[model samples]
Target: MGNKNISMAVIRRLPKYYRYLADLLAKDIQRISSKELSEIIGFTASQIRQDLNNFGGFGQQGYGYNVEALHREIAKILGLDKKYKAILVGSGNLGQALTNYSGFKNAGFDIMAVFDANPRMIGLKIRDYEIMDSDLIESFVSENNVEIAILCIPKEGAQQVADRLVKSGIKGIWNFAPVDLDVPSSVIVESVNLTESLFTLSYLMKDGEEA
Candidate 1:
């Protein structure tokens, strides 16, 4: 199927499917039918089938999907096998937490360098790499093959830093800043709005109480 044809809703569910499939594989679960998988993930059987079908059908009519095989296919779809060389652009609490997250590597995002504007944080080591000066971002990116940038900087400085990253040849930006960013069409930006998600949870809880 063409990229334009696929709904964002389906795209958003990809990671959930990938994680659940990985869990199944870990448990040595050999195979799973759509209905059984739906029971586990809370999606309907037809919904799961439709989502998987969008990327080319992996399951058969009589038989089910092979857990390992399905997991591998989803991993391929998510580009988990290709470990992307990435840089982190903040050194504060959120930045430090993200730097310590080993799951990013397992999911194919390799954060090689951490950058901060703070002079005090420049020399500090987080995980394996020392935090570098944010001023050096343009030059460092120019010198290295940096594919993705993790934006953990404050909202006030995010746009400027993102501009530098885009100019320095970073194609993807995983933005954790509170404010929304305006980037060019070529540069992909995925914003993780923590506050928005929290508010959404609150709304859901209130709605449940009313129901």
Candidate 2:
């Protein structure tokens, strides 16, 4: 199957495999069998083999997977090599925290600029980039060729801002707003609803305690 045809479950697992392989590489380990990797990441050997095989099977039959090689392959599949440009909107607590995260840049989603609707926040600097007025988002996105937008705006205004982002040619949005956004079918929006996630975690913890 082509990469585009890969299942979402397999796609989601790619980052896990990439992270574990990176750890092994950092520890100076050169190779790992599927069975060994499964033990480390809590996946079945067959599952690991099957998932990697979907992308042409990086592992050899006898020698197993080369850690660095497999990591590079997974990172390629995840588009970490592209260093996609992104912009952050709504420079509140969540937005600032996301801007402060170095992992996003390390993983190739570089936030080129930050913006806020608040006049007080517009001139503030986060890290190296100055926060600009949200009014300038369209022109900034156009000039920068930004592929993704990170939205940390309030729910009430999320849809309007998302519409503007879509109009400005952003292909993807990483939304942290409480409400869902309505965008074109061609535009992908990944919403991170922190409250819902916390509730789910609470449920899991309660179940574990009862068990």
Candidate 3:
């Protein structure tokens, strides 16, 4: 099956595979059987096989999988091989934290600029980037050919900022605004709702206690 046909559940599991494989590689592990991978990743051997098969089975029947090869493949699949020019709006606590994160840059998402509406926050620096006026976002995005936007603004203004980003040719958004964004099908939005995730953890803990 083609990538579009792959289920989200399987796609979600791919990152885990990539991380564990990276860990194995770091430990000087060369190859691992499906059963061994399952034990480490907490997925059943059959499930791991099925998941990898969706992206073309990378493992040999008896030889299992080459850790380095699998890690490289997964990185390519996740688009980590290419660099993306990104702009961050909302340079408050969350936005500043995201800007300070070096991991995104290492993974090919380079945050080129940071923007803020607050006059107090404007002209501030996060890492090497000096916070710019939100008014300049559209121009900056259009001029620089920005591919992605990281939204850490409030929910009330998130949609407005998103509209501006979409109009300026942004293809993807990493939204931390807590509200679901309304964007075109051509534009992909990956949202992170911290409260919702925390609530999920709380639910699981409560369920375990009741059980």
Candidate 4:
């Protein structure tokens, strides 16, 4: 039951699985044993088996799982199986780069709306979606039924944007600002800091690596 629950925790590692699986699938690799997968993913064979056993386990007593099946199963579990509509906040460099990024749309997530208050940018288009006035967020999101929000505002504005997002009926937020947010517990917020990761990599390169 614990292993089953851990497998349910699998959502946290979907990106790793997706990346590794995509590589294997591209290589035309079909089936793989738990031990082999463990070697590939740096997990222990037992851990791999336990994690996979929850929703997908295919190894024969002696063989292993069919890689393709496991790949699709993980994709489905991560909500990547369906197209996700997203709204982006801010029209600054960081936000524009993401809107121009082809990968977000290609990877089953689409930036359907971009918002900003800057008059110069409000009518500009990025990745096919013109920037809209931030004041219209609630109406735009409600009318379009937006499910995801990508926040690219300044740190000082993080909590405020989060508050607005929660009120806008957004289900998930991918926050890019360097700040902690406070909102109703019902909303999901995912924050990523590129500067921290880059500095961490540099630190590791200068010294050794740290977990």
> Across residues 99-211, which tens digit of lDDT does each residue of candidate 2 receive?
99999988788899999999998888999989999999999898899999999999999999999999999999999999988999999888899999999999999999999
Cα RMSD for candidates in order: 1.4, 1.4, 1.2, 3.1
lDDT of each: 0.91, 0.93, 0.93, 0.82
- Best to worst by TM-score, what's the order? 3, 1, 2, 4
In angstroms, give how far residue 136 of model 3 lies from its true place.
0.6
Determine which window of 10 residues in candidate 1 has minimal summed lDDT.
1-10
lDDT of 1 by residue, 1-211 (tens): 3467889999899899988988888898999999999999999999999999999989998898988888889888777878799999999999999999998887778888999999999899998989999999998887888999999988999999998899999899999999888889999999999999999999999999999
> All candidates' TM-scores?
0.95, 0.95, 0.97, 0.87
How would you encode candidate 4's per-residue C-alpha lDDT over 50-157 as one tens digit per residue? 766665565576868777887888887677889988999999999999888999888889888899978899898876888899999888888888999999989888
Best by lDDT: 3
Which of the two, 1 or 3, has more lDDT?
Answer: 3
Encode model 3's per-residue lDDT on 140-189: one tens digit a residue. Answer: 99999999999999999999999999999999999999899999999999
Model 1: clashing residue pairs? none
Query: Which regions of candidate 4 deviate over 4 angstroms?
Result: 1-4, 7-10, 56-58, 202-211
Clash counts for the predictions, in order: 0, 0, 0, 1
